[model samples]
Target: MPSVDPAASSMYTNQAYNTTRTTDATSMDKNGFLRMLTAQMSNQDPTSGQDPNQYFQTISMMTEVEQMTNVATSQTAQLSRQKDTNAQAMLGHQVSYITQDPTTGASSTATGTVASVQFDDTKGPSLTMADGKTLVDPDSVTSIQ
Candidate 1:
């Protein structure tokens, strides 16, 4: 059996194995935590086992990550509401947008007064034209008169 250096073993870090970095490098999500934990378990020195303190710290960190994700999700929902409110204020104001035909995949410009705004978590904010039937994306608006 090969001998292991105790100090080197204790000093092992996730950085050594994490060869790639993504746009969200500043964050360690739940999945990231799990991957790191799995790696640690797989690579640990079998004779010494894991430090109990480190295990507890990992659990604490996971809780912190869960809280952070909740807060971020809440903030996003709040911002979406704000955007919907702003879109609602545009009701009765003239707006123009590009329309696409589902069958032909052709685009055309249409102009009408904003009649209503719909807030959807999946679709964000959408506008209903004064025509009472035409639906448009706020982002599709080319001009506001």
Candidate 2:
């Protein structure tokens, strides 16, 4: 067998075996974490096994994180539905809101009857006045009659 240089072998090992950097700068997401964990488990010395308790702890933490994420997503959807209901209830009701002139940059208070409500993913709930000209956000309404 030919003699191998230790420095070249070490460099080759680093180049071949090291984990790649993730796209995120601040933190590793779930997929990255799992890949890293799998690599560590696979490469650890078989003579002295890694602690089983550490794996259990990691699994328990991942479960808790996933559960919390699900709960938050559910709550957000619930809140959005509630807002839609509230906006719908305001239909045919007179509302007062502030408006600004496009030409002169002046603020004025205007009253209008809510003819329809629209839900936008980007802009949230908006009310269409009876006139069909003005669009008002439910949050912008100062008074509802």
Candidate 3:
């Protein structure tokens, strides 16, 4: 029978494996925890066996961790949506953005008509300029016109 070391199994199963670097929500889920628990149960030593109390404690801890992660993810998504909504409110208003001319290499400020506003999955808001250029916050915007 295959035996699993709880500590090693837990470490491998609970490892942070987020695909998106900007947020932790990408990898945080209940399935991973459940898989870890299953592995622990399957690999437990048969002679001594696993302690029921310890197993219950581990399950409880996993539940709490999963709940906490869900809460954090929800909060982050809410905050991001709020920020995007706030940015969308600026639509139709003329905004100034710092754009560099490809040829000139000098930073020139441009005030373009706000064509539209968009939000990415990770980033909050992106403003579409009348000239067809999309600008993201901090890097693309200089001031709101």
List the pairs of residues colliding in candidate 3. 4-43, 95-145
Would you list the clashing residue pairs of candidate 2? none
lDDT of 2 by residue, 1-145 (tens): 9999864442212111225744558787787889999999999999998889999999899889888966876776677667777888999999999988999999899999999887665455789999998899887788999
lDDT ranking from best to worst? 2, 1, 3
Task: Write model 1 residue lDDT over 1-145, tens digit each, in one string.
Answer: 8999864443312221333646565877678878988998999999997889989997997888789867876776667666666687789999878999999999999899998776653566788888889989888888888
Best by TM-score: 2
Task: Report the C-alpha lDDT of model 3 over 1-145, residue by residue, as the tens digit.
Answer: 8999854442211112345446376564567778877987889778987878998998898889878977887776676656666667767777777877789798877787777766544454677766776664634666765
lDDT of 1: 0.76
TM-score of each: 0.57, 0.74, 0.56
Best by lDDT: 2
RMSD of 1: 18.3
lDDT of each: 0.76, 0.79, 0.66
Q: Report the alpha-carbon TM-score of model 3 versus the true structure.
A: 0.56
Candidate 3 wrong stretches, greater than 4 Å: 1-32, 42-49, 103-106, 119-124, 131-139
